[model samples]
Target: MDGAVIGLIGTVVGAVSGVLGTLITIRLGGAEQRRTQNDQSERQGRSSAYSALVTACSRTYRVGYAAHATLQAEGHQQSPNDAETLEEFRSAVEEALEAVSVVKLHGPNGIACAADNLASAMSGWRSEVELLADGRGDDQRASEAIELYEELEDRFIALGRETLSGVPARP
Candidate 1:
């Protein structure tokens, strides 16, 4: 009977279509899932990098502040300041600058600007330290160092404020 044959053919076609449709839908869903996962991974990587940069900058800033405090506390304004003390302070500044450089935090324009300012400040501070360690200490050098360190402090403060606004704080 044609009716029976037609029914059989329709069922076979319907079953085949259902199977093909399911395979296509599964493939599409898999592709979508992969895209979603990739997006999440990229976001997490960005977040980690951002957090690391901020942490490195903050830690280096704190070190610079400590060095500044030590310099001031150790007969800062007096003539004939201790060579050892100045050298130690210089070392701290150098170490902090190295720390900042290793982070490679310059990016996203605004962050880059802050990083540049901070780098300039660090360079100035390190130069003064080198001068002092080289027995080239002078009142002028000390005054200049103070100015440079102040700029460094300002940059870090600004960075911290901006980063805090963007990055979540610790729980």
Candidate 2:
């Protein structure tokens, strides 16, 4: 073959190879971008879910205290020492724990575990609240319950601070 013809063939092959390589690189880059976008979307979803959990926990706490206050004013005359009232208050604490437990910012963030512990603690305190609510006015027992709840509340506050960096913990 003529030298010019051979040179022309070589140039065409090099040009075709470059075009193919560019197309392959573009495709790969597009695929990578899609994966990153998906990952970001997933993180956003998890974040949203975590926020809702905190809200639920706050709701539980608010409702429990509200109920206690309302019942006290109404003078329903149910012995605070009664099992039902104790159970209800304990449940409210549990709900608060549930919300705080949404702190899944890390593995075994222990929100659920802490909440379970708080519920157990509330059960112990319930007896005193029961007396107080019943209008029996067991000062010591109520004081003990308050002290215990304060500790649990502190734990929740710490967790809230750690898990929700940008958001403030609910009052």
Candidate 3:
């Protein structure tokens, strides 16, 4: 009887150990899967945000450039039909602002700051164009605004590429 009881005890211990090991493995696997899923979701979000910002900036730049060229050609002669062109430019600026806001929400601080600088440059450029349309501003201010906008746009694109590539951002 003593031997039989010892044998039963050994069997029970083996079963419990096996069960515990399996449970631990399953739990660990589930945790790892969750972590992978979360990482993928984060990457997708960042990608989407970066794409939106880039597209918005490109569209805005195109529209703004056209408006600037038109204004330059007009040269201190405000036409009655200029209102339509100015309105289109304003709409483009608003769209770019909206995109910048999204970038700020999803991107890191450095990228967001670059976006902000770009937006500010856009505003300055728009103001310069408006002044030109009113026959009150010189070409120098408009040129300066364009240069600043280009610089900021380059910075923003660099930061965005670094972010998407998983590279550490530069100071």
Candidate 4:
């Protein structure tokens, strides 16, 4: 073979290899960017869900505490017109449930479970309060409900913190 022909073949081979390498690098970089964007979007979604759940839980707790305090002050007396207060409590519970639904959709399984447990505890406490007002429940039961609700709330908060901490800080 001629020396010039051999050189021409070598140059063509080098150029093809360079082009393939560039194409592969670009494809891989695009994939990496997509993965990064997906991670960021997921983190943001979880963070927003966590915030919403926490806020709803806090509001529910406040309303429950107020109702419980009022009952305590009344010494569990039978009031003929407690409908308004009951309705307010129910509204707060509904809000919490809605927020927890969001958490279940956006958060990890563990966090979702924790939020569910907390909501259940809150509901139990509410029922216990109703029973107390009707003079059908004992102080012991109400106290137990309160303790369970508090413990679940603490667990939920801890789970939220763990979930948030695992998320990387945004630039």
Candidate 5:
């Protein structure tokens, strides 16, 4: 209980407390850094998925529009390349549908819903084109279908932008 002994005990306690604090700080900092990195990675994945969906949808729309226009102009004539065009349009739609799957996997529900809407729009357009080829639809109907698809596509793009930019979706 001499002054030197008391001082030594006090110094030891202080050193132990300082080490524990440093360890705790380091652990917490590491956890925070890891959490941030994970968030960033998830965002990147979602961005990629959204971009892919957009690209796929665009391609499908273009192919479908072209096919529909050709069918309207040719009046059901079985041109040699008509088969090829049909195949291309089908492939594009399949790709877009697959991209929608990717978006769903990386989704926050809102973007996924938008993606689904776009996909449905594309399918509707494709159906209109099929009806056109079958003489069940006219040019005006094809045009309307395209318009609907474009509107849905714009919605999807807007939602993707908001999601990627960290803006919350409006309810």
Candidate 6:
């Protein structure tokens, strides 16, 4: 081939190679960006769900403690407002249950387990409060239930913090 024809062929090949390289780079960069955004969104969701679960647990614990205190003060007698108090406690428990489900959905397994433990502890505390109000339980039982619930709640909080900080969950 003549020099001009050879030079033309070389230029065309070089141009095609540059275009392909640019296209591939753009495509890979876009994919990486999308992956990063998805990771960030999921992290935010988990954070919000964990926070809600903790708040619900706190409310339930407070209500249970109050009910226990009221029963203690009245010598286990069912007061006129005992029904109302029990109803309020039940509502708090229900809210906590819903929050647990959310945490389970957004969980890395370990956090879900912690949330489940806390919910169970809260339920047990409620049962103790009921027994005390009905004169079937003593102060010690109520106190023990409260202590267990508090411990489980603390565990959940710690696990949630670790999970949010990108730590792998402990079995």
Which predicted model would earn the best TM-score?
A: 6
lDDT of each: 0.59, 0.59, 0.84, 0.82, 0.86, 0.89
Q: Which one wins by lDDT: 2 or 5?
A: 5
In model 6, the clashing pairs are: none
Compared with the true structure, what per-residue lDDT tens digits does model 2 show for residues 1-171? 999999999999999999999999999999999999997775565455556554554554455454445445544666434556556666766665455445444323455455555555555555555556667755565566656765875675555455446455565
Which lDDT value does model 4 have at 126? 88
Off by over 4 Å in 3: 74-76, 168-171
TM-score of each: 0.55, 0.50, 0.87, 0.88, 0.90, 0.91
Task: Give a tens-digit lDDT track for model 4, residues 1-171.
Answer: 999999999999999999999999999999999999999999899888888877887887788777776776744565654556766877888898898889899868999999899889988998987776666867788889888988988888787877878753232
Pairs of colliding residues, candidate 3: none
Tens-place lDDT per residue, model 3, 1-171, is 699999999999999999999999999999999999998987788788878877887877887787788778743367776677777878888888898898899868888898899899988988887787777878888989988988888888888889878786676
* TM-score, cand. 2 vs. native: 0.50
Per-residue C-alpha lDDT of model 6 across residues 1-171, encoded as one tens digit per residue: 999999999999999999999999999999999999999999999999999998988788788778878988844567779988988998999999999999999988998999989888888888888887777887898889899999999899889989999675465
How does residue 28 of candidate 4 score in lDDT?
100
**Which candidate number would show the highest lDDT if scored against the true structure?**
6
Cα lDDT of model 1 by residue, 1-171, tens digit = 699999999999999999999999999999999999997765565456555555555555465445445444554453444455555555655555554554344344555555556666766765665454445755466567667656655665565455545664342
Misplaced by over 4 Å in model 6 are 74-76, 167-171
CA error at residue 32 for candidate 6, angstroms = 1.1
| Candidate 1 pairs with clashing backbones | none
Q: Candidate 3, 9: how far from true, in Å?
A: 2.8
Can you give the lDDT of residue 165 in candidate 6? Answer: 94
Residue 138 in model 2: shift from native, Å? 8.9
Model 5 over residues 1-171: C-alpha lDDT tens digits? Answer: 899999999999999999999999999999999999999999999999988888888789788878987998843675768778878988999999999999999988988898888888888888878777666777787788889999988888888888889775574
